[model samples]
Target: MSSLTMMPMSLEEIAQAVQGRLVAGTAAANTPVATSAFTDSRQIVEGSVFIAIAGERVDGHDYVPHVGAQGAVAAIVDHEIADADVPQIVVEDTVLALGLLAKHNIERRRALGTPFTVVGITGSVGKTTTKDLMKALLSHMGSTVAPVGSFNNEIGLPLTSLKVNAETRFLVAEMGANHVGEIANLTSLVPPDIAVVLKVGVAHLGEFGSAERIAQAKSEIIHGLVPGGLSVLNANDEHVAAMSAFAPGDVMWFGLPNGDGGNPAITAQHVRCDELDHPSFTLKNGDGEHAEVTLGICGQHNVMNALAAASVAMRLGMSIDEVASALSDVTTISPHRMAVSTVNKQETSFTLIDDSFNANPDSMKAGLDGLLRWKAGSESQPFRIAVLGTMLELGPDEKDLHVGIGRYALEGGVDALLTVGSASDASLDALAGAMADGASLAGDASHVDWVHDIDEADRLVTRLAVEHPGAVVLLKGSHASGLSALAERWQALAAQ
Candidate 1:
């Protein structure tokens, strides 16, 4: 974790510029960057370039003492410093400087005409899952470098970029944005040769203020595309389809329905899944050839992730069969999302859907749709319930977004509901009030249940599972909801 190890090139080419400036420490051409470089002090290592920026919760500059003490080679700060002992690189903005340094670091690598190829992906949801799938596919083809998990932000993007070099074959990066500045900054750093917009929704409608603003922010991935680069999109996602007008290069799209009529650059046909709704299907292109793929994991939403990954693979010259074969067997990483969960003990098996990583209105509905379909298929399924928590960090549109999710639950066939937190109460109340009005709802209203907290909800889930014997339960919330703890409880019960 030594910052030096991550910035081998940056340190050597400093030319004493890094002593007080963000210049190369050495004269060697194409300097070797360290193992990995990062600006977040929370994930710091020796020789790391500590870019101190003022975030919403805390200012990294105040933590400069800790980062400097941790062996950071230099501190990139927005303020002019008087710390003579600290190698401080003064910049107008730490975030902006990180982007510049990262681009400079990559420019040296790109100059050699090496095998490196950058793949950038952006969307409202599924960015991480898509990145993971893309990495899995590309690694099978060559030496691949991808952002670790959800490290798709300003600091994370550049750190992921520095890992790419002359020998690297595929460089995959996940581009995420909260404000307009973030996407533009991250995009300029990697300058991807290809880009993918998985899909877009109202996930961050609060921050960007509107879905249109969110779409514009998500579309920034195309800004840094290498000339003549390819843009792969999810045609089913309205926000993504709008991107076709903004892309500067070739555009291709994938969809569940081929009716978009431009023959859907690629279409997943005869899609089928297990009772869990994990999809497996044949991907057909213009040639009418079919490649069968069985997604190891279950979830219709994830199937869309796979198809999004496949479209990029196709653009990379992978045969349809090769794409299918590559995705068919590889393990789909967890916490990305899925349809349902089954907790089986020595006697009884319980069904649960965990879409808890993070939720927005659209993904919430998708999760409900998948869970309800599973519940309906199993007629004897005891109780169909939704255990929901809050979706945080959503500035203003939180209430509306949460309400939209609740409406989907009522409409998507959730039999009973359990909500947590006041933010979540806003959603659950809407469902209850709407159902009270006798509006046509998903399932029996007599089964409706609401909990004020996780403990209360847990008690209900355990009781319902034990009594009903066969039920499909869904637990979804933001990162702070502690829904995973509930899943852990279910897992423990199943183990017993």
Candidate 2:
């Protein structure tokens, strides 16, 4: 559980930056502070500053003494702990103090007058993938710091932005939100010199109410950009494309050109996927410059992600060829997002497409499409098994959305469909029942089955692997669905 190593700041400097009073302990002001910051007591490395975050399930304040015992240099907490011998920086709000400390760190880096660039990316989907791509491309130019995973919220963004130092030249911040103004608040802390909005989807419909609200929420990144900053937008999405009107600075477009001569600054042409659904395309810029890029990853949706990253890199003075080379070399950095790996059971093996990290309507369709395309071009006919789990966060239309995906799977010609989880609370409106019913009614009942939970799904998955040799199994759903754990189980079984 070791966190990333960070530059050390003195105890006095940290307390001053957060505007907190060092109320306790006898540590010297000049002590080269903690090596890094920690929120969880168990993750505390020697000489780390622990920030006590208050949560409903667990109060981090209760763990102050625990982290202090683990050699923490200081603790930032809302309440003063009398028994704790460690230096305590008492603040009114620990969360706000964390953000203030992060902003102070960024300001210190800027005062050094170094060549630092911050690229902020926000979207309903593909934010992490695009962030990974941006990091790959930007890493070629200079020292870069992006989020560890989906660390794009208030707490995560500050933790990421605080990583920037004198040597860091590029910072890629992935911004995500469940409601309005969350991105705006994040942007206030780490405003971007460049902003990339991939797409606005219904990923958090339950929280935001409507797609328009989501679009509105995504546009906040544009408004929060630094003066004269650049915007990299997806021209294919109407909601994303519409964001260009709000851009105070210049804007660059990426995606497939409509060929009505609506040439974007960066685009993909001659796009095609291999039998394994790995995409290859010609990277074209507005000046008619183009280079053939063969991606090392699977999924056609990644083409748009690559284009977004390419646009950002090119804006920062990377040539078209350099962008293409860097992009083609990037395999899947994040796990379970179109990650293609093989699992062998005795004499036979199957290709496992683990897009089970998280899911929504848009991502679910993308995973299914990729799964279908992977099957289409294979020389050996492989049975496509889609073990779909519940897609959480859809408001009222969850049932219809789940049912639609089920129908889409049947129409996509998937063989042996399996849905996990129980029926909805009333009228069996649960996502599993809706999906299973859609498949059963669309095709033969024998081809579709519903399992009660992830354990049953795992057992069924093992059985399927044995029965159908060379089958391609796709695992897709939200984190709540637990398909990601199932995917890991399958991978471990294969390794055996």
Candidate 3:
């Protein structure tokens, strides 16, 4: 987590890199930009460059004047900023310009003869967690630069890549895509020395149209690798394992020992979780030297993510023991991904598993599995409640997917279920209702409930907290569901 000293880019060099024309304050073209570029004008500093992206609601060009007045050296814009005091680099598309600038930055770093390794990671799910884990493991060897949160798209990847300087030894580039060619373009911007494909689940099935298409999109990272670059594949996922044929170089497998056919270069054995659901396992490498890793993070699904990271670190010359020690030291990742917390209300307290960051069918099941493993520290069983919301972008069979998750929860012995929906959107309401119907049909009707929105869901959960002290509540859904906001509200109240 050490702060990086960004390599300076002159305003003239920036314009040439992005293929833009510098206007307004042309005298400052030689000004050395020793800081990072920003899309938000509010984050502008003395030496930073501002990228004016024309978003849907708010036009970044409107803030050009404000950023110029705040001492920004230059701004990259699609159109000329006439009144702004800072120089403007006009390009056909500001986003593309941003990518080009980042590409030049990475290439310049390489030309300086400093040793650097860029690892590109993509998958239908588990991309963010694996990125976080890899960052932790790589940081042990040298200074590392990784994106904050799930910054995996064009803008995010470039912004993260721009943070790399002469001193940085590792850059964990998280790449995500909603359709075909997105990951390929991202990989072109920052071609990885090592590529990691975690799993090929139906995360963005609606956008990509089919599972095979999703696999093809995810494989772009493997095909985009540099010459002699190694690919890390998940042996547990057949779709991902099949990508080995597209790799330009060797492939390293990581998964459970019982996975498909090939022996995983890195695997976890004897996996178990405690009452709070934090998993512990024996970390084993292909050479058979093993180390015990008791992860500080919750969820059994993360074992695969840890192994994926271990494979990369071991390939980069870190010992198996070093990888295990680093993995054990990581207590949490980006917020709301199986983040466990204790909420204390007026007279009762409950365990809250906030996996409300984002979800698909695969991740929803993983969240419920973590909830089912939770214990309340008494002889009697703990009351388990799952508060799920609409999982968007699931395509024509979205209802069937929601229903399947609800059935999975009830059949797996969940005590209660609350599905959140939008009172304003009937389509969303129907999806939530479908989940309720599935749970009721699978178990007792009295245990299933569908609330119109987060507000109503909150009231019911509050009452349930008072009635069932020490209950374990799980909040999971897509980002638009606002479930993470609800989790934050409860967490703030608990803190107070």
lDDT of 1 at 185: 73
Whole-model lDDT, model 2:
0.85
Number of the top lDDT candidate: 3
Score residue 18 of candidate 3 by CA lDDT.
97
Clashes of each: 26, 1, 0
Looking at model 3, residue 445 earns an lDDT score of 70
How do all models score by TM-score?
0.82, 0.94, 0.97
TM-score-best of 2 and 3: 3
Q: Measured by TM-score, how close is model 2 to the native structure? A: 0.94
Q: Give the alpha carbon lDDT tens digit for every residue of 68-167 in model 2.
A: 6798888999989877757889999999998888887777777788798999999999999999999999999988999987888888998888777778
Could you tell me how far off, in angstroms, the CA of residue 390 lies in candidate 1 after the best superposition? 3.8
Model 2 clashes, total count:
1
Order candidates by TM-score, high to low: 3, 2, 1
- CA displacement after TM-score superposition, residue 178 of candidate 3 (Å): 0.4
